[model samples]
Target chain A: MWVIKRSGEREEYDENKVKQALLRSGASEAEADEILEKLRGRVYNGITTHEIYQHVRRMLDRKRKIRYSLKDAIFSLGPEGHFFESLVARLFQETGYAVRVRECIRGRCIPHEIDILAERGSERYLVECKFHNSAGTRCGIQTALYTYARFLDISEVMPFASPWLVTNTKFSGDVITYARCIGMRLLGWRFPEDGGLESLLESHKLYPITILAIKKDVRNSLLTNGIITIKEIFTKKDRIYDILPELKANEVLYAARAVAECL
Target chain B: MWVIKRSGEREEYDENKVKQALLRSGASEAEADEILEKLRGRVYNGITTHEIYQHVRRMLDRKRKIRYSLKDAIFSLGPEGHFFESLVARLFQETGYAVRVRECIRGRCIPHEIDILAERGSERYLVECKFHNSAGTRCGIQTALYTYARFLDISEVMPFASPWLVTNTKFSGDVITYARCIGMRLLGWRFPEDGGLESLLESHKLYPITILAIKKDVRNSLLTNGIITIKEIFTKKDRIYDILPELKANEVLYAARAVAECL
Candidate 1:
């Protein structure tokens, strides 16, 4: 079967590709085989990868295995910039810190708009979020160095505050080393092995709304309006309905509850 | 007499320096001599270069020679970013073009916020404003190249619109050559020699309020509220008064009139 990719390129579909993906997501050998067998029955001559992804997501959602496919949902949160900042801020807030997003703070040399500022008790964190919509991109040394320089300027005034750099994607080895050397906390999608962005989100039961199986434009509209987390969608359901009035009330509520169940 | 420099180094006050600056401004040798003689009585030990600048500015303001000193006034308009974009937008408006500031246009690859979009008759221009707060900085080839890429992405959609790069400071020779080769119009502090940013502002009798000698915080507050041009200050005088309630009414009105006189 021919499968269309996101970039509009066509490629031959392989059952092994599906099996491997399921296996990586912690599916047992028998479970992976059963899903592939079911998927094979629905194969067509020209099916989009997005269609296949939705099919798999639905199957996983039914089996309570959506947690394994949450990464793909996060990737849907694009074209990236401020939306990612909001996601990071929401994540921090979920962990019991008061968060401020896109704050313009005066540094010693120049003024900078910090992505996230989180405070818990006397401890404050000035976060620099580097978000990459494409999984192929990685945060590098240049980003770490620049963040460190800004931190140096800001630390003069707020010495008690610490600098933390977070990315939706992973960081390069050089960036990790430099950040470690400077004592700057570095978080990525999956870098610290035991505790990265995914692990933290899983720990806090905080999943971004982008992972919901809704229309892309609806997800983008919600993100644009600073609605990212499942909790936000639940709490601000009326606002979400107001922004996307065309979307049915039950549909929005169902999607929110569906994603919240996975979290 | 001692004079301080921008770098904070102190040097003996030289009459020749004053004469050279005035001569560069198109003052005749005799006129330069007369200005220097008048300035001699005001010289003092440990006097700052900024103090000397005020004396020279007063002399120029009196003689309507403020054109020569307008660059310094432009530099005063920052902790830079969006304020400079507003200034450029205002400049385009003064030149009889309908302008849009911070417009997000959809490009082929991604969305881009064009700093200024100027439309006049059948002509449309996509402008990128590179603002540098420090005098020592210059817009380089990287900026030119990156801007060219965005222009290419945008021009596919806006085929009629040409790309123009404007900077508060000058451009390096390499950047000028690259831009010229690509047919991208370039504007900078002293670029194109005859009609740079300074000349453009002077020709149109447009000057930003940063040169108004008000407290930096007040000027910043005004710029933050989208008040950049002298006309904006005059028209939005109440907004300025509201932002700066601590300042007496006469103080704001007097500063507005003082800057207006130069224009």
Candidate 2:
């Protein structure tokens, strides 16, 4: 069997390798085979080895035991700045809000950067990651502007209520007050005594922004597109997308990309 | 009348200037009369005009309407750095923690460069300020170590928590995770977006080394006794101060000086 990976690569799968990975992820051998079979046609030539591994991992990620452990371990090490990103995603998921990590906002003319965009029902939130030694008030302002820009790019179809600035460290009083004045939510993480990853994992509210849900239209688009590639979706542009509604063009692209990728 | 300014200088006060300032701060003439009279004895030679104003501001800080407006308008923009410090103090105060700004800590044989030791309940937090555009992770680490040393010297309280590294900029992921693993809380003010004041406020946590705190106590005792001047405080010999907790010889001298100063 074979499968495609996130890097647009394909790889041949060894049954033993698949079984071992599944076991590590707490998945049964039979279950692994079932996943491999389902993903067979999706595999293609010139797939990197890591892609093959990722394919199995993504497949097993659907299993409750696999998903929980995989996330638990991933969030524990605080790896590649992905630790907080994953935490944010899981938090959005747990809150019953549809969340997309690394949703690119773009327009016909330009590209923009935004980390996690979430939506629930009519409420939408634009979130940016600030993984620093400490997140000062300055971070809040940057996030506020970024979110506001994102809001401008998207129409009322954008589901979040306000822009959010979430950081690993606490925000200064002035920054918090400024954000409040500008209608942005500034969230900070308080330190624990141990200063270990365990302490961080124990706190979910520290993940920064948590929205209620995404727009039904956006959500449907993502589910239907089955977006797995980064380039096919998420453009990097800031052109206005709407005239009557006066939306930034980049936001529409992000909405499209997010809908295409995660159902 | 005379008062000390933030510059550590004293200057004479002008009555007309005082009257004009009181109006700016929104004090009624009757209240201003009472303040001028109350400040009579406390005023001395060579008081600065700014000091007189600060004194009045401190007094008015007790009032409600005036206090809020003062915080929003005057203090918030004054000296920018002081504003942030005051903000930090207020945040801690709201959290039921008593915060001390610009308190120095040093061991007997060491130089005194530490600043802002905040005590909340049984825990002591050491904060060092850095106001700059670019700062590295090492700066954060150095502050945390010094804070740890200061804690051990002063209160004999040993903290199990990792020291904190608070800054205004983000750090490399490896550095942050490594610092966290070794028991350091890397905190950075999310800068520009928040405000650039985090670099002005050093915030971190560290283990307490009682020996270091005691060393500082003895040095302070000597300096307070007139046996040594402020300049001599940093120039003293190495290995000074009685480190033997059970046999505190320097403490006897400290107590003796206390009595003499009282006399």
Candidate 3:
């Protein structure tokens, strides 16, 4: 049989092979076989790798078989973070963008945090997440103010770029009006225009970050131990598979390159 | 020239003479004169003794002319503690009900906590104030629960009494409906039915409690000197009024009789 993946690639489907792969990924033997049986009609030759991974992930999550460590990595939103990153991760996934939450901005002796950084094709967005009842001067006017500040800090050595502020709280009425007046694209939580809080993630079409992307991203990023910023992933001009494995094989080379370029 | 007194009562007109009276009450000569100037036509001969005292209180508040001790006392919300007291105080005053921010609850060991309790024409209302966000249960329902609980407590002694709940945050839709279903009145920071906060006070024609009332009540209850709680006031009503100089000696005897019977 053959299956078409989310990425529109075709893949050969072999029940035993799929079951073995799921087992290797920590699913129990019976669990893996059960997944294969459930996914029987969905498998096909030339199916995208992403589709295969998705099948395995959904199977595990449905069975409540997720590992604690794996769950933490999936949900982590960096230090002292709020729930906005979770919302962004969910929404971006629905928008067909590959999203990662709390990817570290690594280069120098000190590390930085990005709330979320997502990419689709060559397009990438660096996002800072904020949640507030009413926006205040410091955190309100520019939700991404901190991102820009971080950018300035790393611009000297890293190829620093691509940032946006994604907030659960809307900008102040005056600030929103002013932003529009000044031609700044303000995307945030607001009613009617964006479906308010109740329908926020639903309207964005991202209910949750799919588990496959989460597993693969965590595996690759931890392999090199060199921090991956969403910026680097977007700027690579290639699929994460191509870039991630190479960094995994040669951590020293990747780290050197990352440090040499100002991000 | 006539002057309104501290009790909200009108008195004989004598601009300089009333100024001297304010000075005798510890106001600076200049401030006393200034208060008297503000008091000019507000007074009329044969004005009630209570009205004369109220004029002084208003002048002091408007001009910020009271001694720091008295100022602190007025702002403290004596027996009604917490944000609810402040909200009720503001609401009651805004509604034109001669609102006393904190009325000392006429008891021993009740402590000084102002939770806005409004009184008009022999009808006394106790209000519990709450300020909450969308995250918690609605203030309306919560307040209604408290009202029921308080009513249960008081009903054991005197049956069929209800208290009101005032909140700074607006109620949730379902919570509001539920509150209405359960026969609870919901008040927001502003409501047209209440004639808005300020107009509510205007219509009620109520004034703040006079210092004399506070002093009289405090001494009668002897709250500052150590008596506290309604129970104590009831039990010790026999000698309560004699200790309070501000009360007419006869009124004290009558109040003691009332307290004993209520108990």
Scored by TM-score, the top model is 1
lDDT for residue B212 in candidate 1, whole number 0-100: 63
lDDT agreement of model 3 with the native: 0.46
- Give lDDT tens digits, candidate 3, residues B1-263: 33444434554565565565566446787787777677666766666434655677667642233321222233333433342354356556454555665444421211223365566666656665664432123344334443433433333543333455565445555445534543445565334254433234323422222212334545334544333322334455554554555355445445434433422
Candidate 1, residue A139: how far the Cα is off, in Å: 5.9
Residue runs of model 3 more than 4 Å from their true location after superposition:
A1-263, B1-75, B78-128, B131-165, B168-185, B188-263
Top lDDT prediction, candidate number: 1
Model 1 misplacement above 4 A = A1-263, B1-20, B24-28, B37-52, B58-69, B237-247
Q: Write the per-residue lDDT of candidate 2 for residues A139-194, one digit (tens) a residue.
A: 43334433444444342444457766665555555455545554766554432234
Task: Please write out the lDDT profile of model 3 over residues A1-263, one tens digit for every residue.
Answer: 66554435555655676665565446777776787778876756666655665666666743233321122232343323444465556566667788878877652322456677678887766666665432221235324333443443333446524555555445665445433432334456443364543244433322222212335554345324322333333334254445456544344344334432421
Error of 2 at B42 (Å): 73
Candidate 2 lDDT by residue in tens digits, B1-263: 46554446555666666665565455788877877787675667876645555566666533322321322232222233443343444444445666666655433322333335556767766554433232222233223333443333333333423344444345444445434443445445443234322322212111011112235565344433322221222233222242224345455344434323322
Chain A TM-score, each candidate: 0.80, 0.40, 0.38
Report the Cα interface RMSD of each model, rounded to 1 decimal: 11.8, 16.8, 22.3
**Which residues of candidate 2, in runs, are more than 4 Å off?**
A1-79, A107-109, A134-140, A153-160, A190-263, B1-263
Provide C-alpha RMSD values for all models, in order.
Answer: 21.0, 21.0, 22.9
